[model samples]
Target: MQNFDYMTPTRLIFGKESIVKLPEVMRSLGKRVLLTYGGGSIKKIGLYDRVNELLKDFEIFELPGIQPNPKYDPSVLDGVRMCKENQIDVILAVGGGSVLDCSKAIAAGAKYDGDPWDLITYKVKAQAALPIVDVLTLAATGSEYDCGGVISRTETNDKVGYMDPLLFPVCSILDPVYTFTVSKKQTAAGCADAMNHTIEQYFVADSTLLNDGFCESMLKSLMVNATKCIENPEDYTARAEMMLCCTYGCNGILSLGNSYSGWPCHGIEHALSAYYDITHGEGLAIITPRWMRHILNEKTIDRFVKYGINVFGIDATLPKQEIAEKAIDATYAFFESINIPMHLREVGIDESRIDEMAHHIAVNEGLENAYAPLTEEDIKKILIESL
Candidate 1:
């Protein structure tokens, strides 16, 4: 195994009644809270009122309307402003990954005087940040447990993933019952997103039996439970398993000692989501398999073979190259089976911006020396094939 250092400081409170622990976690965090949510869905599901009732003792300020591919504007900017003006102490993210992502940005921004984008883009690093506590209402993106968040700047079509240990929530409360109401579209998208997270790590140029088993188990659990979730949204077992899968995704547990993947699919999908405001997870699902087909070669066949045998139970005796190709095809078919749109045009993206997307990715994501090398031309080919 490669030499490495690892740390996961976030406290996880998970179970059926974990929401009851919110007030105590908030007590350790701060007194005045900056409460963040998206589009009022949490309110529709009565979570807003529930949180209000539970936190009746604490002072709260609201930052609503955080969107998917959560933007640096309104959510982060307004949140920072609220923090500065009202002297908000800690941030409480109360919706899905987008809300938590925006809250994370706001937490970092609230403690800095510079533009948050500067921090998000790594133009400046955060010296300190407001404490964050989250109540997860969705099972994707894993922002609850990780120190990274993807934020968009519409003016520049830039969607950047920002990471700083300072951004991790001091604690997260996960009650899977909260996700029982998520629409199937989002349910499938969430599963696909979480699955892609593990696959990205699993496909890297490094190997360790530790992460390999974790990746395979996480992948199979997500796929099987996600399908069960689609068939029955209120199945607590499926929702719990999926929520756990997403939590494991961005938290670095599945990638310890693995080589850097450059997260090429995420880099490419960021362009689509940032430009068109597509659902981040759905965009990833649509682009992933196509990228897989584009990148498969003799150099990368074994990882695919192992993934097929371990995760999907493909026959091990098949030709190795054929196993790899079938694995790629099975991946594409899984997204299709979940009703995720499998092509860019189907999602309103087209070839016109493949060159632009490629150039932007080259400039932003630094995919030149990724695990599988991808030049701008290579990125364009992948994008074109995805289309």
Candidate 2:
């Protein structure tokens, strides 16, 4: 086990119609607000109107069209400006993880004088931020319960993960029914994202039995319910469990008191998404199995063996190396079985940026201390093999 300090301050109200309490939550944060969302999905599903109706008593300022891999330009910059200009008291993110992510930055940026990127890049820690409240519409990213969000810079092709204790939502309302329209592809990708979150923690060199069981249970739940969610989008039980799994995915609960693995998949996929702007989770799915195979060693094989036998039920009698290899195969096959494209080419990532991405990871993501300690050359090889 590793030495650690942990805290999650976000209050979760989960269930059907939990969103009806939106106004009450907002009331605590004051009146003027910035309503943030992505490109019109909420409108299509009548959530836009419902939110407008619910906030009829409070002043509303709209910030629309936030994109996935949420950009820092219009969403964060514009939202920060809006909050400052309108005297906005509370920030409500009304879309998936991307929108909520953008809003979290905006909530902090509104209070800062310098560029928000300074806070995001860790040039300065965010000490104070406007309170954030969320009505989650997707079962991915777990941005609601976490203080970290990934923001993209189109100008530089950089996607940076920003974390601050001040950025945790004051309250999050999770209604599983809101995710009923999530496409099968997104559902699978979302589950993959959460599962990868667990695997990242599970692979650590320093770990505890408590966290290991938490990660394994989360992995099993996501793998089992993700298919049910895809096959029947309206299945409330599957949707509820999967949503909760994702909400708990990345907030350090599954990794509490655990040593870091340096999150090697993230170290690689951040380059892929930052370079080509591919979907974050799918990029992770593509690189994960390749990473596992590349990093297999006696030092780490025992973890893979445990994962194989415990999570996937591979026979414990198998040889250690074969068991580890089988675990990697099962991982790739699970993503394939869910119909996710398991290669870079399938997701419009071409060869021109391989060197560029490798260099970026070398300079930006710091892969030197990864679970397997990948250098730029090793990263290039992993990318090539994944390709």
Against the unseen true structure, what C-alpha lDDT does each candidate score?
0.89, 0.91
lDDT of 2: 0.91
Q: How close is candidate 1 to the true structure, as a TM-score?
A: 0.98
Residue-pair clash count for candidate 2: 0
Assess the local accuracy of residue 288 in candidate 1 as a C-alpha lDDT between 0 and 100.
83
Per-candidate RMSD, Å: 1.0, 0.8
Steric clash pairs (candidate 2): none
Worst 10 residues of 1 by lDDT: 1-10
lDDT of 1 by residue, 125-232 (tens): 899999999999999999999998888888899888889999889999999999999999999999989998888888889879999999999988998999999999
In candidate 2, what are the lDDT values of residues 90-154, reduced to their tens digit? 99999899999999999999999999999989998887899999999999899999999999998
Give the Cα-based TM-score of candidate 2 against the true structure.
Answer: 0.99
